[model samples]
Target: MIPTNLVVHQQSKVLELTYENGSTYCLPFELLRVLSPSAEVQGHGPGQETLQTGKRDVLITSLEPVGHYALKPTFSDGHDSGLFTWDYLYKLCENQEQLWLTHLEKLAAAGLDRDAPMTKQGHSCGSH
Candidate 1:
């Protein structure tokens, strides 16, 4: 299903996507950043997932179209690696609520906050 409209609610940091199939999805800025399909996040091969950190207050600065099937999101942190494909964005939107809840749960389990202090190297420490 092709998205008919993609709206970014800057105040709420949510992306509202409406598809031609009558489905509407709302995804958070943080979720999209962490779950980016870019090689930087997903890595170059399997078993190489890189956990993103310090993205609690991150926001989407811009959303640019990549040809006809994807969006190139420019994040506030200058990250533009993820090319959010229509299908992938739809999936994230569809699973937004659950995914966010799970993310929160994982954060809680690890005793981490989104705004937690960064280490000296400017990166967050691994999950405890």
Candidate 2:
């Protein structure tokens, strides 16, 4: 199904999308970054998922359509591997609030912070 409406609010860094099926989704830039579908994040196969850190401030710099069904989202941090398909994007949008809460919970449980700094040694330096 095609998206009937796609509104990108640059100021708020939110993408509000509405599908032809009457489903609406609101996706935040930061959420898209942390949940990127790239192999770097999702891994090459099952059970290799990598949780992203220090992405709380990540922002969407641009959004380009890859085709009728997906978008290549450019991030301010120079990450652009994820090709967000319409269906997948819709799911993210729909689950935005709950997913964000879950992300925060996971971070806390792991003794990590989304905005933590990375040291020169390539390790995150902050309260965990």
lDDT of 1 by residue, 92-111 (tens): 87777887787677667767
Give the Cα RMSD of candidate 2. 5.3
How close to the true structure is residue 92 of candidate 2, measured as C-alpha lDDT?
85
- C-alpha lDDT score of every prediction, in listed order: 0.79, 0.77
The local lDDT score (0 to 100) that residue 42 gets in candidate 2 is: 75
lDDT per residue as tens, model 2, 1-128: 45788887778877788877888777878788888888766766785655678776677788899968799888888878899997788778778888888878877987878887533332232312
Give the lowest summed-lDDT range of ten residues in model 2.
119-128
Considering summed lDDT, which 10 consecutive residues are worst modelled in model 1? 119-128
Residue 82, candidate 2: alpha-carbon lDDT: 98
- Please tell me which predicted candidate would have the highest lDDT against the true structure: 1
Q: Report the lDDT of model 1 for residue 21.
A: 82
Looking at model 1, residue 26 earns an lDDT score of: 77
Candidate 1 residue runs with Cα over 4 Å from true position? 101-112, 117-128
